[model samples]
Target chain A: DAGVTQSPTHLIKTRGQQVTLRCSPISGHKSVSWYQQVLGQGPQFIFQYYEKEERGRGNFPDRFSARQFPNYSSELNVNALLLGDSALYLCASSFPSSRASDTQYFGPGTRLTVL
Target chain B: AQTVTQSQPEMSVQEAETVTLSCTYDTSESNYYLFWYKQPPSRQMILVIRQEAYKQQNATENRFSVNFQKAAKSFSLKISDSQLGDTAMYFCAFMKQGSGGGADGLTFGKGTHLIIQP
Candidate 1:
């Protein structure tokens, strides 16, 4: 089975521009989460959606938002981007379960460079 | 709130040698999950290993193993028979157990960059 897939591997945006990153989860997966990784740093959680509803949200600002579709695909949107917003946006998908063993598989992140 | 810490920013190991990457976390919740993720140059975050807080026995996957100490809040990854493919950035992450099958997104550490010498 194919793993999580992301679109527009790399993007360049201006300070005030908006950008959208897409992610298609693995088949049979129902939860999708978004994370942002700065250079030399680990990824920071942004938003998590399960079954097209927001299940969890990180400490990111209002400029960042995400939604999941019925098919379990997701999109992360950043508005009024700042230079600080430049980083690798990652997408992870997992099965809906309470067990800790349910692993979240990640995608090749989309690198967003804001100038 | 939870925090994962990886003190060593970088480490190096010769081929076929064993290397251990250290990680310490702070969390108030008793039921949680810890994970070690590897990110290669391709920038894909791969799940290396995971340990549940409630489990006393450590978790291992092939050449990768984790020494999980719940009391010390230390979870270390030991890679045996290291290969050049092991060169990558390793991140320690934490997640709290939520109710109703919902998940608390991961809290990650400042990763450690591991290099394998040929």
Candidate 2:
């Protein structure tokens, strides 16, 4: 079975520019969540989408937003990006919803660089 | 909000030896899940082991086992007979109960860089 897949493995963006990272969840998975991992730090939750609805969000700034598609694929959009936005954006998928202990499978992640 | 902490920023162990990585978390939710994920140079996060709050017995997988002290809110992972393949940044995570049978994305610690020598 194909696992979670993320697009644009690497991206380069300038400060103030916008970037969008994509993720296609595993087959039969309904929930997708995004995380940002800064260099040398563990990942921090960004946003979660289940059934095309936003379920939860983290302490990130307003520039970060995400949406889930009908097929469970997700897009994380960052507007007015800052230098601190340079990090790896990871997409993880699980079945049902976020409250369950369903194991989450993660993608390789998109490495975003801001200059 | 739940917070996870990995006190060791980095640790090194010789191959075939045992090494333990420490983690502590703070959460108000009585029942939740704790996870250990490994991310190598490739940046793909892989689940190592997980422990449910309700289960008193520690969870073990292969050579990986957790020293879970529920009362102390401490969850540590022990890797026996380590291999060079074990070299990676291991992150401890906590996930609380969200509505809807969904698995909440984890709140991760800063991570411990585990380096295994050949």
Candidate 3:
């Protein structure tokens, strides 16, 4: 089965511009989450969606938002981007069960460079 | 709130040798999950191993194993017979037990860069 996939592997944007990154979860997965990884740092959570519902959000500003589709695909949007927003955006997918063994699989991530 | 700490920023070991990466976390919740993820140059975050807080036994996958100490809040990864392919950034993460099936996402450490010398 295909793993989590991300689109526009590379992106270039300017300060105050807006950008959108896409993700397609693995088949049969229903939960999708977004994370941002700065160079030399671990990923920081952004937003998570399950069944098209917003389940959780991180400390990101209002400029960051995300939504999940019925097919379990997701889109992460950043508005009025800042140079600080330049980083790799990652998407993860997993089952929505409470099982302790459940694991979240990640994508290759989209590299966004804010000029 | 929870925080994960990886004190070793980088480690290098000869192939076929054993190497251990250290991680410590602070959390008030008793029921949670801990994970070790590997990120190669490809930048894909790969799951290495995981352990549930409630379980006394540690978690192991093939050549990778973890020494999970709940009392010390220390979770260390041991790579036995390490290979060059093990060269990558290893991250330690924490998650609440009922984090809505991980909807709350993971609390990750800054990561340790592991290099296996040939």
- DockQ numbers for every candidate? 0.66, 0.60, 0.76
For TM-score, the strongest prediction is: 3
Off by over 4 Å in 3: none
lDDT tens per residue, model 3, B33-99: 8999999999999999989999999899999999999999999999999999999999999988774
**Cα RMSD over interface residues, candidate 1:** 1.9
The pairs that clash in candidate 1 are: none
- What RMSD value applies to candidate 2? 1.6
lDDT of each: 0.91, 0.89, 0.93
**Least accurate stretch of 10 residues (summed lDDT) in model 2 chain A?**
A96-105
Q: Is the docking of candidate 1 incorrect, acceptable, medium or high quality?
A: medium
lDDT of 1 by residue, A29-89 (tens): 8899899999988998888898899988888899999888889899999999999999999
Ranking by lDDT: 3, 1, 2
Q: How large is the i-RMS for each model, in angstroms?
A: 1.9, 2.5, 1.5
Model 3: residue B31 alpha-carbon error in angstroms: 0.7
Clashing pairs for predicted structure model 3, backbone only: none
The 10-residue segment of model 2 chain B with minimum total lDDT is B96-105
| Chain A only TM-scores, each candidate in turn | 0.96, 0.95, 0.97
Better of 1 and 3 by lDDT: 3
- Backbone clashes in each candidate structure, one number apiece? 0, 7, 0
